[model samples]
Target: MKIKAIAAAFAATVLTPFAMAEDQSDWALVIHGGAGVIERGQMTAEREAEYRAAMHAALDRGEAVLEAGGSALDAIEAVIHGMEDDPLFNAGRGAVFTAAGRNELDASIMDGATLNAGAVAGVTQVRHPISLARAVMERSRHVMLQGEGAETFAIEQGIEMVPPAWFFTERRWASMTRSLERLGLDLPERPEGAPELQGVDHGTLERDEREHRFGTVGVVALDSDGNIAAGTSTGGTTAKRWGRVGDSPILGAGTYASNASCGVSATGTGEYFIRLTVASRICALVEFQGLNLQDASDQVIQDELTAMGGDGGIVALTPSGEIAWSYNTPGMYRARQTAGGDPVVGIYGDED
Candidate 1:
């Protein structure tokens, strides 16, 4: 009788931690806007409330999917697609204008189950770039397609395509004009004329140029099935020329996923990110070097990317229900929630 009691206690002890881990895995989702200087004083109460509401909506959508036993890929796509439709973010309908005054969107998606990936770049007519990215992964033979070719593929695949003007917004247009002015390019003046300022000089111009370097929105999720997935979308950089492409459309640079490891989404200077292979490097460090998710992300974003003079951040989630949110910039628009809990959202470093 004593032996039976001892065996039962041991079994309960061993199952406790597993039960805790299982609870943690039900639905973990995280999202981020581009990292930049987000000052609380500059944001109005109304604007802050809007951001909070948007993030909460995203968290709820993903949670619903997990609650229904959906895959991580489905949950990640649903959340990101919702953000793409939102004008407050720089993606899909709300993308910034290119140098040619047209919207050029890019997007990528990765499946941790098979490690398969898909991407689209320089697409102008696709209504939801994330949907096109998923189609590229599941329906098409190519991993990436660009420009008109991508639009053509999107149409053939029955994805929604919108008119070019549908993507234009007054705020994004204003941002593009400012970017062009900072780069010393001549642009048509606003109807109200430029505002007169005191003491604005070359230094201010240089700073403005640097401020426009970051752009993109992403999501990383761990579903109830213990699978991980990541998705990223962007309108590319403002005033970019020569059909320029950013890291958001690239697989290893902008996003990565592995069922045995983690999913990562990066936002920053795409050039430096691609050279560093930012997303894949994080997974490699964690899997090969035995580093935890947080340490691996910090070492890459702070030590590696910062060392290269690149400023940006990454959102990552491990299969074991761990979340790693790291960035070297002054702030990053980010939100996170585990399972059915309340979401934590922030725009600046100090808020963290």
Candidate 2:
């Protein structure tokens, strides 16, 4: 081809028109349901459609907040609350059962403007743990509260409380049983009045099984005011033992935000995330190393995590509204919306 023809081809790709949402809006947002072995071949059409719809709803909800001139922290809080209400992903209503046959939730939130953050862990009463996390950040001096103490603070703050049974769902219960069986955990005897349980195959653990034990839901957003924020919540690993609290509530592990660099929310095996300080590490890469948002996110999720025998993903946003995400797994439930385009949501590796 002639030089002019090649130049024209490149221009065409660069100058393609997009469906803009607002004229003066200068904001962006992205959310993730989780990252695991979510392959298209293994998902039924109905299931895929369900996930896509949920992701779109989350993106739109958060984008609406930003378009209305809401704070980036508000957008992330609202987006994460909606996912926690939906029983589809393991965060709020769909949290997995622990080895003790009960629900224990963990959540965290961050404000990039002042490095303010709050976290709550092993709280079973709060319907929206993210809100409790924000309360801890804004209402108190502490960065984290755990178990009954967190619940007490939430109750004191007049946060809406739910019964433990409210989070019980058939899907999460089944996943818990399967994980227990794989780990050879002996269950209590089936009583005469109890229903007979059916055996289920939860699928393969694959390489890095220890680090890919479960999934989490999270969000990162940038507002018109140039502030960034991030939040994360999780039901935790299925059949998790000994009151274990994953990185979801850890400020520098599964969630971090910084106006000086970027905001990040992580999902996957929480232990590995904590060990490597994944979320803060990305921000450090951007702030200290002068890497762009995309480069830092890719360096952490794609290269570092994978090399460490961990599998997961993250969504990140810079102060300038640049967005990026990376994952080594087959799929990550993710979506993004900005002023210049409509929402884009995907689940499988091919979609990425």
Candidate 3:
């Protein structure tokens, strides 16, 4: 009887928590800052700790929302918003420099249960691009808005607007200047005064080059109610010209969500991602092809990115509470929290 009672008690203690956790719908959340050349040696212990703290803060914000029964969309937006406001990860306040030496922000959000999406691109005045994206998704009929029009819509919707200078940073400006100088040094000099073309001084003239150094910020969340959502934000590309926009504000490219499958947020080369539909493709592969979330993410980030001649990474969470992360670069800043309260966070690729 004593042995039987001990066995029963063990079962009760172990199984009860699992049963309750399963009953709660098994919530999970994941976030990423971007993927790039991150080496373990390059990141000092202090820097790594800072990155981890930021990631945890973002996760904690989202977890609170999920615990309080907030919709997955809300949780995702809140978490991403935190990153956007921080200057560390290069989304909103810390966006990269554009060709014109300015910052142009982009963001998107999606609700998996309803397929509702919102996006804003080339936004200069909005204080929080993600908030504008949510407004576009919920208040406006359009899926995306750009430039002054998007700003106008944001103003009408009561979104906080800031000056263009609000997006500037000294590091970004210095980086842009250095990049232009380097590009000039790499170009071959033409014959001395041969056909002095109007406005064509290849060596002296500085052409705007976009900064591809930083990664976008994103969140994927599964709430207690079994709903999933994803959100993404970016500063576009550093030193980009001709109003070039990246995958961040484009649905299915940088952000995607589906109630039947999962929610995904991507950070990498924007042009390649847009062509391959990286975010949506991951969800489709998992839902339709029966691939696990990790396998699907790997296929998309590795196979798909290679096929498209692009590289980057993604963070995802499925409705069944599985976490998926994949990156082809040397590193991607990411974090996760399981329904069981375990937390994992890292910046370098092998930091696990």
Candidate 4:
């Protein structure tokens, strides 16, 4: 009789902690607006303020969702929607022009709880590629779609569509022209019906804005239900050609999430991120190698990615509400917020 009583008490002790852990109100969200050689000297004070304000607005959007018990997927998608509309970041409207003088965007989304994912690449007309990616995950059997086919799918799914000209930004066009000139290639003709460049003072990209040509925007979140979700969006690299698809639309490369491991959204040199599987590789280190989120991120970004000569960074969130980020570049535009905690934003590498 005593043995039975003791067994019952032991079982209760072990099970109680798990139940409490499940009920904890822990939630977190992390976001990044590209990474590169961003130094204080290169950024004007006005430009810096604009970036910080955008990050704060994004955090507020996501925080409201999580605080209201929204799913991690919804929270991140909401945050990314605002960034996609804002020309301050390079995802949707401000996307860089390709070698063909077109804006070919790519994006991916993953739900950690189910391991379901979707992606779209080389999409030109979708207003929000991230939303299309999510639609693919929920409504289609395929994992990825690209180009005209993806646009057709977006239309069939009632995803918002925009004229290609709507994506044209003078800054991105100037950057593309300069890139082509440097490559000693013939300049591309402007797309049909492109709006005339207006209110642009400089024809050439400033040093600080040079890296903006390679920017991407991403988000990773862990909700109160302990589900993790990650999403990434980009306009590939400036002057990309041959229907090039970067890591942003590739699952397990630039974007990955698994409730058993971690959620990751990466921005960097797409080829290197694709080769190293940077996103999932970091999560693998955490789940399989028993490394904490920070150590796993460091190992993947600082050690392995650096050895491969990759330049960029990643933001990761664990089911346990841990947030981590690592970058090999001079700086990464990043932000984070947890339930009941203040939002913290960073741009320069020197910041903690």
lDDT of 3 by residue, 1-352 (tens): 0001111111345332112233447677889988877776555578567778999999899989987888888888789878877867678887876666667899999999999999999998788899999999999999999999999999999999877767665555555556656556332233232233334333212211221364699999888788889999999766677899999999999999998988999998899999999999999999999987778888888787877779889988788676778888877888887565666777766554
| lDDT tens digits by residue: candidate 2, 214-311 | 56899998888878899999999888899999999999999999989889999987888999999999999999999877778888888888889987
Instruction: Mark the regions of model 3 whose C-alpha exceeds 4 Å error after superposition.
Output: 1-24, 185-212
Report residue 277 deviation for candidate 1 (angstroms): 0.6
TM-scores vs. true structure, each candidate = 0.86, 0.87, 0.85, 0.92
Error of 3 at 226 (Å): 0.5
Model 1 lDDT at residue 352? 57
Of candidates 4 and 1, the better by TM-score: 4
Q: lDDT for each of the candidates?
A: 0.79, 0.81, 0.78, 0.86
Off by over 4 Å in 2: 1-25, 188-213
True-vs-predicted CA distance for residue 130, candidate 4, Å = 0.3
User: Compared with the true structure, what per-residue lDDT tens digits does model 1 show for residues 1-352?
Assistant: 0001111111334322112253344667788877765566655578668777887788888888877899888887888888888877788877888867888999999998899889999998888898899999999888999998989889899999887777876666767777887798876433232224234344433443343346588999887778889999999888788899989989889999997778999999889999999999999998899887778898999899999998789999888767777888877778877664456777767765
**Can you list the residue pairs that collide in candidate 2?**
none
Give the true-structure RMSD of model 2.
5.6
The stretch of ten residues in a row with the least summed lDDT in candidate 3 is: 1-10
Which rank order by lDDT, best down to worst? 4, 2, 1, 3
